[model samples]
Target: MTIQIIVLATNEKADAVIKQGSLAQMPSLQDGWRFDFRKQLKALKHATAYILVREDSPEVIEGCLIFQLVDKMVPYMAFVEVAPHNKGDEKKHDHVAGCLIAYAFKQSLIRGSGRL
Candidate 1:
């Protein structure tokens, strides 16, 4: 499912999308990402992954999210990372982390129905 999100472009708020990510589209450290996302995905076997990309440039990922339900109850956010361009003061986008976090919370409400 596509979720609406916002990104920064020339200091303006632009539309983006958050959706389920597949192994084929996974990013790696070599791709200018801080973490080796492929390795993280391998290590977090039970987690579900998601990616944030610009609406006009789906090919350029802005961030990634890895999450899962802990013991089938509590929602646990295992990992989250934004592209190098989305980090620090020179960041190209805004709300990259917030959008991923909000997505996790939404998942918790939808899929994590059990109590911890």
Candidate 2:
């Protein structure tokens, strides 16, 4: 399923998307990502990952979220990170983390017992 949601582009002051992504599309440490997502994904069986990318440039990931349903009952966010360019003073986008976090909540609601 292609779950596409909007984010804010700080530079252009427009919207972007946080879509469902694959393990194959995971970023590497060399890519300036702080975490080793591949290793995390491999270790966590319950993990469900998503990536944030531009609506126009889906090839470039702006952020990511790793959500886990703990014991099939509790909603847990294992990890969440914005891209190197999406952080600090030189950031290109805004609300990257917010979008991912909201998506996590949405997932929790969808997968949970319909109660937050």
Candidate 3:
């Protein structure tokens, strides 16, 4: 299975941060914090999942979520948001994000579920 992730930026600032390809890279939120998108794929490549990003602002992370489709048919999803000023929040955000993505996919399979 092949999954595609498209990064969306409102302006040049966010645009500049993104690199091209199946493994597009971007800088982390904190100064000097960087990670390669390739590494993320290496971790998830075995799974039947893909990511599509819509970057509005760092604030969007507060409302970001993930969705997944299995065998191009069954859909599952979940909802998630970030908690401000918490050390463990990042992990929580990731978990919720994954769930939200699955939720969105599942909802898409239903009739008249509307946009996620």
Using lDDT as the measure, the top candidate is: 1
- lDDT per residue, candidate 1, 16-110, as tens digits? 88898997788997888877777888777467889999888999988898887766677889889888888887778878888899899898888
Candidate 2, residue 112: Cα displacement in angstroms equals: 2.1
Candidate 3 structure quality by residue, lDDT tens digits, 7-65: 22321222111112233332233512233223333454222222323344322222232
Writing each residue's lDDT as its tens digit, candidate 2 over 25-59 gives 88868889998777787788678888988777889
Q: How does candidate 3 fare on TM-score? A: 0.28
TM-score of candidate 2 relative to the true fold: 0.83
Q: What's the residue-level lDDT of 81 in candidate 1?
A: 89
With candidate 2 superimposed using the best TM-score fit, by how many Å does residue 48's alpha carbon deviate from the native? 0.7
Q: Which residue pairs show collisions in model 1?
A: none
Pick by TM-score: which candidate is best? 1
Candidate 2 whole-model C-alpha lDDT, 0 to 1: 0.77
The 10 consecutive residues of candidate 3 with the worst lDDT sum are 11-20
**Cα-based lDDT for every prediction:** 0.81, 0.77, 0.31
Positional deviation of 90 in candidate 2, in angstroms? 0.8
Clashes of each: 0, 0, 12
Looking at candidate 1, what is the lDDT of residue 9? 59
Q: Which parts of model 3 have CA positions greater than 4 angstroms off?
A: 1-60, 78-107, 110-116
Q: Which stretches of candidate 2 lie over 4 Å from their true place?
A: 1-12, 114-116
